[model samples]
Each structure stands twice: as C-alpha cells, then as structure tokens.
Target: MTDSTKYLQALEEFILLGKSAPGAAAVANIQKCISSPNCFVFAELLELPNVQALVNDAEHKKWVEALKLFAYGSYMDYKQQKSAASDSLPDLTDLQLTKLKQLSLITIASTEPHRLTYPSLQSLLDIPTTRLLEDLIISAVYASLLDAKLDTANQRVEVSSTAGRDVAPGDISNMIAALEGWSASCSSVLTEIEAQIASIQASAVAQRKEQLAYEKLVEEKRKTAEKDGSKGKRVMDHSDNTGFGLGEDEMDLDDGPFDDQGGARKSRKGGNKMFSRKR
Candidate 1:
C-alpha cells in the first residue's frame, strides 16, 4: 500500500482504539500504535495504570500498541512533528472528510456559524483540545492544502497575481481604525484611573502626617504634665524638711516645766550631792 493509504488506515485504527475499554493486550496495541515517549500516554489511554505491574508487566503491551498508532500517524505527516499543533493539522481520510462535513452541516443547522461560535464538531469526535489546537495550528499553517486551494482558485479568477494576494487592504484599514478608536478610549480611562489613584495616595499621606502631628502633641502634653507633677513633689518634700528642721521648742519658764534657769541649776546641784552621799 502507498504510505498515504497506510497512514489513513492507522489513523482510523488509532481512533478506534482510543474509544475501547482498556485491557493489557489492547493497551499494548495502542502503545505500539502511538509509540509513547513516556508512561503518561499509556496512563491516559488505559485511564489507569494500577493493573500494570510496576517493574515489567503486561501493561507495557498497551504502550506498544499506542506507540504503533503514534508512529504510523507521525510517519505519514511531516507537519505533525515535535509540536502540540495537532488541532491545526488534520489527517482526514475521504470517509472521515465526509463524516466531518456532515457533522459541520449539523452544527451549522443547529447553531450560527459566523456568530463567533466554538467548534462543536470536534466534541462529536471526542477530540482532545490538545489535539484540537494541533489541528487548528496546522490548518492555519501558511499555504496548507486548504489555503493552497483558495490561492489556486484566486489565481484562476484574477489575472493579476497582486490582486487578493494578501489580506484585503480595506479590511486591514478598518481593523486598524477600530483599534485606534479603542485605544483612545482606553487611554482616557487609564488617565482617569491614574489620577484617582494619585489623589487617594496623597490623601492617605496627608492623613498619616496629621496623625503623626496629633501624636506628637499628645506626647508633649504628657511630658509637661509629668514635669509639673515632679515639681509639685519636690516642693512638698522641701516644705516637710523645713517644718522638721528646728529642734523641739524649749519649754517656757512661765509654763513651769522648769520655773527658771536658776531653779533648774539648783535642782541639778541637789541631785549631784544626793548621788555622792549614796556612793
């Protein structure tokens, strides 16, 4: 068989295997089909690797099948190499194309095509988004089969090569105009927001300064009160000392604790003589 035919066959078989309830032989077949570089591909295909033995088990068989599927597809497409651009590129066979067209028609009938709709046709295929992106990137690739067809048709219609060779000039102009208009509005909004932010920052700074000033005033008041309190204590201490400084007041002769200094002297002499006689 031609390489193309073999690739087409492998693609269909891979899709079939992808949907099956996984077993060792089935998983191994899938691995052989896909040629997985890591266990993750095996894990994903089988849905779980718990059944696969840790060291070397029959689960490796699943990976073998997966590898075969992967290899067959990869060998056919140069564009599918070393990239996550699966959605961008599609390896659709004639039968697959027919099915896809039918699916697309159904989608259009049920949903608006030009209303910025997401692709529902892919969901029907149960295509992973990773693969979908790959296909889209491949589809959008410069001068792929689809674009070549368009370019060929354009060349047939237009005598001049320059005519419609690039994006339509008017379309680009309109897009630029829209961008400029949006940019002007965005710039104004940004300016207003910046002004508001600046005002808020200034107000916060002023409030902080006012708070600091108030704190300072309160601190000064506290210090002054403390100083005044200390001074009052000092004055009270001086007054107490002065009151106790003088000796006990002498008894007044008139009050008769002693009649006079002479009487006090005679009493002392009598006491001394009495003490001597006793000795």
Candidate 2:
C-alpha cells in the first residue's frame, strides 16, 4: 500500500525474475532499471555493505551515471585514450570497446587499480552470458553493501562465473561450500551483537532490582520511626495523666469531691456513667 512497500515488492519481483531469466535478458533488465533516476538516487544514498547486489538491468545504468558524473568529471574523453595506451590491444574491436566502457564505469567506482583492470572488462565485452554473470554478482554484492543489507558471511571471495553452466554435482557442492562459508561469517557477527545486547539488558535489570531494594529499606525505616514516635507520645501522655510530680491545679479535671474514705462516685444525670480512676 505504501510507496516504500511497493518499491520493495517491485525489487523482490525483479530479483526473482532476474534469477530465473536467461542471462542476456537479466542483464538487459538490470541495465534499464539502473538507467532510471529514482533507482540511481536510491543506490547513491544506500548505506548497505554491498551496493552492487541490488542492481538489475535498470539500476546498473544509474550507477554508470554516478561514475560518469562524479568520477569522470571533465576527463571523460580522455578515458578511452588512457585505456588504449595502457591496454595491450590497441586495435580492440567495437565490442571490446563497449566492454571496456562498462568495466571503466565499474573500475572507476571500485577500489581496484582502474588502469590495470579495465582490460578484463574489455576482454569480456562480447559475451552476453558469462562476463555479464560475473558483473551481476559483483554488482549485487556491491549494492548490498551500499544498501546496508550485505551480509559478509554471504560473500564469495573467489566466485568465478566461468564454471560450466550445466549445473554439475561438483558445481552444486562448490556453491554450497561458498554459501556456507559466507553464512558462518554472518552468524559469528550476529552472535557477537546479540551477546552484547543481552549483557546490557541484564545489567539494567540488576540495577533496577538493587534500586527497588534500597527504596524498600528506606520505607521500612520511615515506618519504624513513625511507630516509635507514636509509642513515645503514648508513654508521655500516660505519665502526664498519672500526676507523678505535677500539682492537681495543673490538671484539667472537673470539680468533684473524693471522700477520704475512698467511696465510689456515680453520675447523677443518667444511668450510664463515665468514670476515671486516680493512682
């Protein structure tokens, strides 16, 4: 429903299609998407570890534009001249030139030595299936990193696209091994992060419990003080009523006569009588 969700869905569909599509169609599709401005802008701002992973036929063109704009600057025309002079094949064909161009776009953006590596792109210019596959993997990994979605454990350090396309058992084994290696790396990093979070949570819980205990002890002390104060007040009131040393004039008793014979006193107003006894 949301724009972001729509884009994400589109991206997922595109990825699925890319995986199943023939290599030539996949490259074309990815190139077309990369050429669009929206995809280009998104790739630029993405913070993932491998930015190249997300590019389809559409997104790769955007990256090319970025390379052209910021990396190329005013020396765009000179790139071919430089490449021709450095490259072994001065008479490289049109197809080779196109491949060189693509490689130039990528190498300029990459950390590898551009002058030395552009020739390889030149070498693979005509092949629609194999070279493109290598580029696709490279692009996917790069994009994933740039988009903040790249898992290092999923990285294939020695991924070579030239392996036979028939899907042999050995190929499957190699693929599984590479993927397992990548997953292990990712799992280790994830575990470390989880451990740190758990430690912090435990520390916070302990601190809170200690604080509660301290507060409870303070409350108990306050209650005890109040009880002691009340009891002392009661004792003082009792001592005052006994008239141990104070004169009777200081007392608030009503006018009443006590016989020397110590006879009982009764209320004359009603049958119910209220009385106090002196020590």
Clashes of 2: 39
lDDT of 2 at 101: 40
Question: How well is each residue in 16-87 modelled by candidate 2, as lDDT tens digits?
Answer: 555555435544544444343223212222222233443443534343333232222212333544465543
Put down candidate 1 lDDT per residue, 145-232, tens digits, no spaces: 1221122222221111110111222557877998999999999999999999999999999999999999999999999999999888
Lowest summed lDDT window (length 10), candidate 2: 159-168
TM-score of 1: 0.32
Cα error, residue 109 of model 2, in Å, equals 4.4
User: Candidate 1 — which residues are off by over 4 angstroms?
Assistant: 1-166, 234-247, 250-279
TM-score for each of the candidates: 0.32, 0.32
Candidate 1 lDDT trough over 10 residues, lowest sum: 157-166
